[model samples]
Target: MQTCALAEELAADNDFILYAASLHPFARADDQELSEKERYEMIMQELQIIGRRFISQGLHVHVGMPDGETAIKVCNLIQAFLPIFLSLSCSSPFYEGKDTGLLSYRTKLFEVLPLAGLFEYMENWNHFVDQIEDLRKYGIIGGIRDLWWDTRPNPQFGTVEIRVCDLPVKFTSILALVALIQSTAAWLVEDVEGSSALSPYLLKANKWQAARHGLEGRFVDPTAILGDHPMQFRLAAMILKSRVSPYASKLGCDSYLEHLDSIISGGTGADHMCRIYQNTGDFHQVVRAIQKEFWQ
Candidate 1:
């Protein structure tokens, strides 16, 4: 909250307020603002497609793990829950001054970059290291930071970084997401046998559904024995089955996890923005509403 207050004060000094939406609702795509950092310069020079679209933000939660192996295990175990997290935090419903008809349009924009989106399965720490080594050897990427996967094992931080969520509008929403992610990580660590072996195809499909429809999306079950007739469920239902409350209680974040129930019942950030636009019929009003509600 102090950081946000500082930012708000700074922006106020400059005659601008802090706008916390994932994507700029009205900025033109070609209006570029390049950073002076070498890596950012390389991104603009090499990947010419990334312009203002790359300016979008996300809420990345890093949960600490005991070892590299445990980080990899947690990354794999947490893959199935990424879509649910995205749905809960959807905030980029408008892009280029227009309603995009998708909850988290920022997800689609980020996926346009190379090495982005869902990560490939790794058998172990050794396998992950080998893959990164090969990518570096072939000049495919300069380092680990280049691999912008939805979830990755950050060896330097000894943490599993979940990069799937849009920047939610409310500060409490951010806290709730962090609590949920931390609780889920703890649960996964305690119950190694509960790891999900969901197919990569199913994971991608679920992510797409979440980006398109938020909590209203349907999730496909990978365990159905019927090969061509798998059962599907509402994303909210799948989220309830995750059973993270027990871990949250142990971690002393049970109250934060309870906010998830409020999010499910009230709607995501994107849903809130869309409603404001629908009522006012103006993108300006939508953005003003976001700015007003951000610190609430």
Candidate 2:
């Protein structure tokens, strides 16, 4: 069976269970497929372990927009929501038998690169495309490499891809996330004018808070930058439950509340990590526990 098909049809049905898998050599479409690199081969064993644990790890979301411009608009509008998803979906809080304290530390590790984030708004597709062209022309950056944003445009598929969450151990999490992405795109296509514009700083601030607090964070209203008050997962949950539940339900994710309610009550992946730490007081033990619970 195709790996992707297995992920959707089989792995997710039983408690959102996703079999872990290793990550082997990563190749680009423009590059050679087979290589004799020594170091890459040396690490293949560990990579295979990762492969078995994650099964096939990726955040594959399909946006509803027809063009890159709309993708950009929707991406910018929903950038603020990315951290909320991250907080909720993070599962790899323990790594290599360690209590990292950081929820989804695996996901955050990608941010070490300059391009790993949702950046400042592009005025439009013209500007967006033009910037890439200029970067390529000047040799400053390659043409549209996977800049790991919380969300990014998949130009080839004409869909915006959001890479905020960690590898969901359960397939249902992936389905719920995809459903949320689809409904969000649908909402944007129909209600672009209804969204209030937020400055870049406030957006980043909210993301920082969500990363720290997970579902417990006090999210700033994107429209109310100067407002002293803060929003909570309670509000985010309400929006997601109302806007995303129906669509998520259709994708064999009828258990959408199972995922949402997990965060609502248990907090988020980060919250779970904290609980684990409090119990064992060891990072390595946490990672070991996670590896057992998630992979076995």
Please tell me which predicted candidate would have the highest lDDT against the true structure.
Answer: 1
What Cα-based lDDT does every candidate model obtain? 0.82, 0.57
Supply candidate 1's per-residue lDDT for 265.
78
Residues 196-274, candidate 1, lDDT per residue (tens digit)? Answer: 4569898889889889988888766453322234233234433543567888888898887777766777888999998
Against the true structure, candidate 2 has what lDDT?
A: 0.57
Residue pairs that clash (backbone atoms under 3 angstroms), model 1? none
Candidate 1 Cα outliers beyond 4 Å, as residue runs: 194-197, 221-242
Over 108-141, each residue of candidate 2 has an lDDT whose tens digit, in order, gives: 4455545666655777888878877887788755
